[model samples]
Every structure is written in structure tokens, then in C-alpha cells.
Target: MIDPILPFSSYSEEINSMLPETIQKELVFLIDSDFMDWKKIESILKKFPSISHSIVRRRLDVDFGRLSRRLTGKSIGVALSGGGAKGFAHLGLLKCFEENEIPVDMISGTSAGAIMGGLFAMGLDSSDILPLIRNFWLDRNLLGDFTFPFVSLVRGKRYSQAIHEFFKDRSIETLPIPFYAIACNLTKAERKVFDRGLLWKAVRSSTSIPGIFPPFAERGELFVDGGLLDNLPGSILKERGAGILISVDLGGGGQIDKDEMYHNLLGPHYLGEAPSFFNLLFHHLKRKL
Candidate 1:
């Protein structure tokens, strides 16, 4: 059975008339920006200049079943990997899924991935989430607490607060879709999968980097970034009952060996004055981290 979407014509005129000219222009500019390409940009550009509510309605009221893939009774899961800011790419992937009318049955993620997955599971699609992040959340002053060079650079108080505010007391078990967030137990040196409890706390714990953000503490246990243990949480998606898995690994290549790291640093001109002092320093730091 197919779920029907509200017809584009139903509210198109009312919505268009309600928007101010300046706000509409800003939205146009944002869509035209070079950072993103949705594969239908050319079509949008060609039609938008002289667009009409009736034309948009006609264009949208198509036989969607013919254009989209048939809904097979298979569980499709997406597993997102952690790589700090690179996790934002998950938004683009989600947008693609939305465009193609592919339904996401389950999602599992670590670190930054957890944030995106959690938001989606809460019922916000890519279109709703991108604007929220750009216009509000990303603009906040998150560096409210700094710490001496010890276990972490910052106490993460402001960041945690920001997450809590964004979630608005939502719990994991209450989400529309099944979601899993991966974190790590620092004391036990093991992975922790969170499928329930406060959404913000799980996201905070998932993204708590060891030397960057202080480990999150709950009930006598210390939790740090899930990337330390499971950067790509595809296996969890499988274990939970997904037949088809789509894993997005933004971490690029796996860990580099010490020799490769040095070789890449030196480049072709190996007039090596016995590897730079900073190279040895970074190597040691990498091992410690």
C-alpha cells in the first residue's frame, strides 16, 4: 500500500502568497548556490523564473508509482560513519533518498552520524533539517567552556546544552523510525549501542571525542566517541533485522601505518633530514590518542 502525499496544488497558492518577496528571493539564492547539486537543478532553474502555481501543480500530480521504485517488503537501513564535519554529507544522502521516494526503515550511526540519524528518526526530513542547522543551531556560540590541557580541550557544557535544546526532551524510543546511536564506554573500552533514553544525551555521548570534548558521565560510567570503537555501525543495523543495508563511511581510508604517515608527509623529494621533528611529534601523539 502506498501512502499519498498532500497534493502540491492544495496549498501552493496560499503558501506562495504568504511569503514576502525578500524571503522568497533569499530562498531562491540559497537553492542556486554552488555548494549543492540535486541533479534536477537545471529543470528547477528553467521553470522557476516564470513559475506558476497551476504549472507546479500540473507538474507534481504525476503517476508517482510509475516514476518511483515499487515498495517491496524489505527492511532498508542506513548506517552512517563518524568523521566530524564530514558527517554533514549524510544530509545530501538523505536528500537523495527523499527525492527517489525511498523509505528508510532503520538508521544507525556513530558520533556526528548519530546527530543526523536521530533528527531524521524524530520525523524531520533533509529539507527541514538543513535550514534549521544553517539558520540557527550552527550559528550558536558553542565554546562557552574551556579547560586546561588535560583530558580534553573543552568541558562541552555549551555543546551539550545546545543539543538538549534542539531535541526538546525527545526520547529515543518515541521516534517515528527505529534508530540506534553508538557510543563507547571509556572504562570498559567497549562499544555501547543506545536505542532508548534521552535523545540529546545519547548524541552528546556519541560525539564526545577523547582529547577534544570531555567524556560524558552517567551513573558512574564514562562515555566517549563511538568512533573510537565503531566508526561505521552497519553491523548493528544488520543484527537488528535490516535485509538491505546502505553504509555511508565518511572516514575515507582506514588507519594509516606509521611508515605511510611519514612517507605521505615527506612527499617525493625524500632528501629526508631524518623525518621532521613535528612528524615524530604527531606520530607519538597519534599513538597516544
Candidate 2:
């Protein structure tokens, strides 16, 4: 019941400190940046055989590569490589776990790593704050003069209202800019899929579907909320099978209330380019178990 975040190297030590000694030997998984050597990871795993360990390295590079490729058509094929390159690493780890029949005790991290961990828990894609903001700006052009400044200010604010205010101020400053990606409701099918827990798994698998325009709608209930789908192309929404699209604010923010439609923002602190948040998040997940 310790709520430690994951991905930092010291996570193991922290978990050891927090948990009862008898339960300290449980298996753990640490997914983080590709800085640590596999040997080191092996050594750590060996130290706690009862606690198997794994890492998904090069996480950000993978996401950035995917995003960059999407933004710039030149790298489309590479970018579309599902969850970016890091996703492949994650899959490889998952494959290993599957082959070995290893059960993940916990997963954690900030930003992408945190997102994946959250997805593992909630069975959905954790909202990417930067992408959400970028998409918002792309659709509205409201943050023309305030993009960077607004991001800086909002990074520290974790409360839902504070984030709403930030968006409101940006809207007021920009004028006539509509919020394009806010979900007002979940379709009946979407609600049913979400209730069944198939929505998130579909999204994760859909990433691997081949095609220049992979049908997101056909992929089942996307883990996005109604607003996100609204912003997406019409064709994409129509093809959905059972994927649930949770509200942007709810998913991005770490608020864990399953009943609430909204959640806090993930904040810039977690999204900053610095590697610390990633490391910290991963560390927290690996050791906490």
C-alpha cells in the first residue's frame, strides 16, 4: 500500500525501506531509460530471485522518434512503429515475461513510462500532456504567444481547477479559440467495452496494426474520452469496436477515482525533458512491489 512512483535507480532501496521485511522479497519489474546495463539489471534480479526484474530502455527516444516521424512524414514508417522504438523494447520485455510466466508486481514511471504503467493498471493509454497540449494548440491556435509560458506555469499545477484555469486563460488570451479535444460523453458501446476491460488492450494492440492509415475506429474502444475522439478524424471514430476513451484531464492527471469523469493534469513537472522524472517513476515502480 505504499504509493511510491517508479523508474528511479534508488526505487529498490526505497521499497526495501517501506515494506515489511517478509514481503520485501517479492518479484519486481523496473522499466526505465536505457542507461543501466543489462548486466546490472541481471545482477539486481539475481539478488532477489523471488523478485524478477526487467527494464524497458530507451523509452523517450522511442516516443520522440514516433512523434517526430508522425509530425514529419519523412519518418512515418518508423514513427508509426507503435509506441515508438521504446514500445518494441517493452514488448520484448513482455514477451520474456510471458515466456517465463512472470507476473508483474507493479509498474511505475513519469511521462511515457508513467503513462505505460498507468495503462497497465487502468487498461488504457495514459494521456500524454505534451501531445494533448500540442494537439490543442494545433486545433485552436489559441496559445500563439503563450505556448511556452503557459506550459511552464501549468507544469507545477496538479489540481484539476488550476489546470482548467490555465486552459481558460489561454483561451481568453487567444479569443475565439474552441477547445477541440474535450470528451462530453461515452457512447453506449464505449461504455460497455470499458465496463468489460477490453478497451485498453485494443489500443495497445492497435499500435501494431499495419497500414498508412490504420483504422483507430476499427481497433475497438479507444482509451480516449469523447472529446479526444471529437478532435480526431471522423473516420477514425466510426471504426471503433470497444476501446474506451477516458477524459483527457482524468487520464493525464494522476487522480485515481474510477467513477469521476475528470482527473488532475499530469503536469509539466512529469513531462519536462529532464530524465529524472522518468528515472524516478521507473524506480518507484520497480522497488515498490
Question: Could you say which candidate leads in TM-score?
Answer: 1
Per-model RMSD to reference: 15.9, 23.2
Model 1, TM vs. native: 0.64
Decoy 2 TM-score against native: 0.19
Worst 10 residues of 1 by lDDT: 52-61
Best by lDDT: 1
Clashes of 1: 0
Deviation in angstroms for 252 in model 1?
3.2
Residue 275 CA displacement from its true place in model 2, Å:
17
lDDT digits (tens) for residues 25-124 of candidate 1: 2112111112222223333323344431110111232222211221232567899888777778999999999999887777898988898999987768
Model 1 bad stretches (over 4 Å):
1-73, 135-137, 253-289
Per-prediction backbone clash count: 0, 38
Error in Å for residue 193 of model 1: 0.1
